[model samples]
Target: MPTKSTRVPTHASTPVKRRPGGRSARVQDAVYSAVGKLMATQRPDQITVPMVAELADVNPTSVYRRWGDIDALLEEVAVAAFTREDEVLPDTGSLEGDLREWARVITDDIVRPHRTRYLRAMVNARDGVVLDACPCWTARREQLAEMISRAHTRGERTPSVEQVLDHVIAPLYHHVVFALPADTAYAERLVDDVLSMRSAESR
Candidate 1:
């Protein structure tokens, strides 16, 4: 835990150590990795620079000089976690099939103890603003929308792909992330509901 005297670094003060040489970006990545591991177990409020430094096996001064404070460090950590390879979007031919795959992929991640803990923390802290701000959100949503568009190209549904994404799949996913029971069957049911909605809309 940071002491009162340990000032939280301003967002501006938390300069990313990215330089033209790439040396600083590497260092910044290491720090963010350490913080991600910590976030798996601890809430953002409990994360500290010393703990991150210890995990990265770098001196505390290096952490401070690079990231400035724990909050900035935490933000970077969240960003890195979001961009990790496990979250990459997959392509399948059909909208329903793709959505089922997406639901499975998403739930598999959310059901993990580490990720669920972090997600629960974010949800409890406030509506999923932290997750929403992640760059991956836009990227993943776009990919999903593209999948939905492919369904439209096939004449699979009446509502536009964007409507399905915004109304059905997105809301279901949000519930899965923030509120729904994290069961495989439950996830499948959500996918079913989205597909049913699409079919009805088409009718």
Candidate 2:
């Protein structure tokens, strides 16, 4: 994981250029939806570009052209599915409340059966290649940065974004990936732990 001082890279592998809106948006949505449906019944290895193309009612060439291969497609789909880009950030008048709500929302989302499968599939698709940047991770980091900034503006002492990611967000996903319990209590504990780090620093 990159530290607070280190800049994160902007792309995973090669940057995939996607055309936004109109037919392009529709096709992308269809393909993403197809991948989700397939993941419900089949493992990541069992799914193929052709299967997705057929299910999505789009040409295989379209999938190939836009996403390259099945693994790439799966990665893109997982990134899209995992990040809540459209939602508003949690602002509960304090950094603690924001972190707890954010963690709770994440825990609730990733603990679902389908989401767990998607996460596993995304990991498997990586095939051991360490990415300097992942869209999903970047999105979460950006959200955290915003939340942290808000807290700063409100005169609340808070942990660095990296600290939050390391102590809270990372552990939540770690538990999910490892099939460990990542319940509401676990998320709340993580929030408390990270907040405690700030208190410890102040002391």
Candidate 3:
């Protein structure tokens, strides 16, 4: 039997801090846009801080002061691009429905060409950082926790967070990172497999 994967960290260990508005926000937005545009035409490995600063029309020092390094900037940009901060979590009245809808949304988003590029860029930017340290992974884990909490309140049988991460989330990301097929059906199947664990536990 496969041992359960460790729980993903609920939050980033070192969150990026920035002033909300005024000149600082503008500069950050420009830098993020510059990175997005560059990633469209250039590999993340080839892009440099100077290149980003030049494209954003900001001084190289500003980029460095804000993000410190090209890899850090890329990771931040990728995280910002991937997360929908304003979007509400699915509340479909059941864990199965919620997971299916959530999985479908994730499958649709990550499988897009631009998102695929960002996912690849995020992976390259990490070097060898554990998944627990990744802001993107932490965000997804938090979302999953919220959904699972709702299920628990409703007295629904639910799989542990580790089981969901291992059976559902991990497989989807594996397919994506490996350039294999990861469609809505595949995502839903993973959800089904994880939910089966809940059934097994009850039996």
Report each candidate's C-alpha RMSD, comma-separated, in the order given. Answer: 8.4, 6.8, 7.2
lDDT of 2: 0.78
- Candidate 1 shows a clash count of 0
Models ranked on lDDT:
2, 3, 1
TM-score, one value per model: 0.66, 0.84, 0.83
Which pairs of residues collide in candidate 2? none
Q: Report the C-alpha lDDT of model 3 over 107-201, residue by residue, as the tens digit.
A: 88788766677788888877757764456666678888899999999999998776887788788878887899999999999998888774434
CA error at residue 116 for candidate 3, angstroms: 1.3
Which 10 consecutive residues of model 1 have the lowest summed lDDT? 1-10
Off by over 4 Å in 2: 1-19, 198-203
**Overall lDDT per candidate, in order of appearance:** 0.57, 0.78, 0.76
Candidate 1 global TM-score:
0.66
lDDT of 2 by residue, 55-117 (tens): 999999999998899998887777766554345689999989988998888899899887888
- Candidate 2, backbone clash total: 0
